[model samples]
Target: MRIQLDDLQGPEIHALLEEHMRGMHALSPPESVHALDLDGLRQPNVRFWTAWDGADLLGCGALKQLDAEHAEIKSMRTAEQHLRKGVARALLAHIVEQAQALGLRRLSLETGPVPGFAAAHRLYQAFGFQECGPFADYKLDPHSVFMTRLL
Candidate 1:
């Protein structure tokens, strides 16, 4: 798989994000949802990436800088066809490497507590992330499970 910086305007990225939103809507409640739309993903504080296998878009992920030393993971989704094929794992490892390269000492993320998100939660924990209370500007929310890893 090829991982690279992506322009949010790219059609592949747009398609993957649309798919992400649809999946979230189907699996989680509206009030608990915090996934970024195109406008939000294009914000100044965030950097997005798309993974491709030649002409096929495999997945996408992003990092949102929270402050000088912290960043939050965002919009990690693997195409349904690519699920269980290591796309999400590759994207996640790439994101963590980028965070460390940026001098971020910690990475945190919020994911749903729904069954659909179980694999993601486990994947993160396997990467050394631990349950944590919301940090930065995030508030406590019942449907959100917060995890963090010290880089």
Candidate 2:
């Protein structure tokens, strides 16, 4: 599969992001939901990418600049049919490589704490992310789990 920068304008990507948002909302409370929407992902400091196998969308992920030396992972989601197929792992690896290329020293992310998010937590842990307090504009939230890693 190939991972490429996306413009967030394609129907497939739009649908995937919508599914991500829906899943996030269902897993956490409205106020605890931090997943970026389509417009939010279009911000200047955020870079979005989509993983594809030929014409099929496999997954998507994004990196958001929090400061000169810190970056946040955002909008990570694998297409339903692509689960357990290494799509998320490849997309996350690509995001980390991009962050390192940009000279970011730290990478952070926030995800829900429910069992529904166990696989994601495991994935992050495998990539060296550890639990931490909220960063950026985030505050202490029961439904939210914050994690970070030094690159």
Among the numbered candidates, top lDDT falls to: 2
RMSD versus native structure for model 2:
0.5
Clashing pairs in 1: none
Task: Kindly report which residue pairs in candidate 2 clash with one another.
Answer: none
Q: Model 1, range 68-104, lDDT digits (tens) per residue? A: 9999999999998899999989999999999999999
lDDT of 2 by residue, 24-82 (tens): 98898899999999889999999999999999999999999999999999999999999
TM-score of each: 0.96, 0.99
TM-score of 2: 0.99
Off by over 4 Å in 2: none
Candidate-wise lDDT, in order: 0.92, 0.95
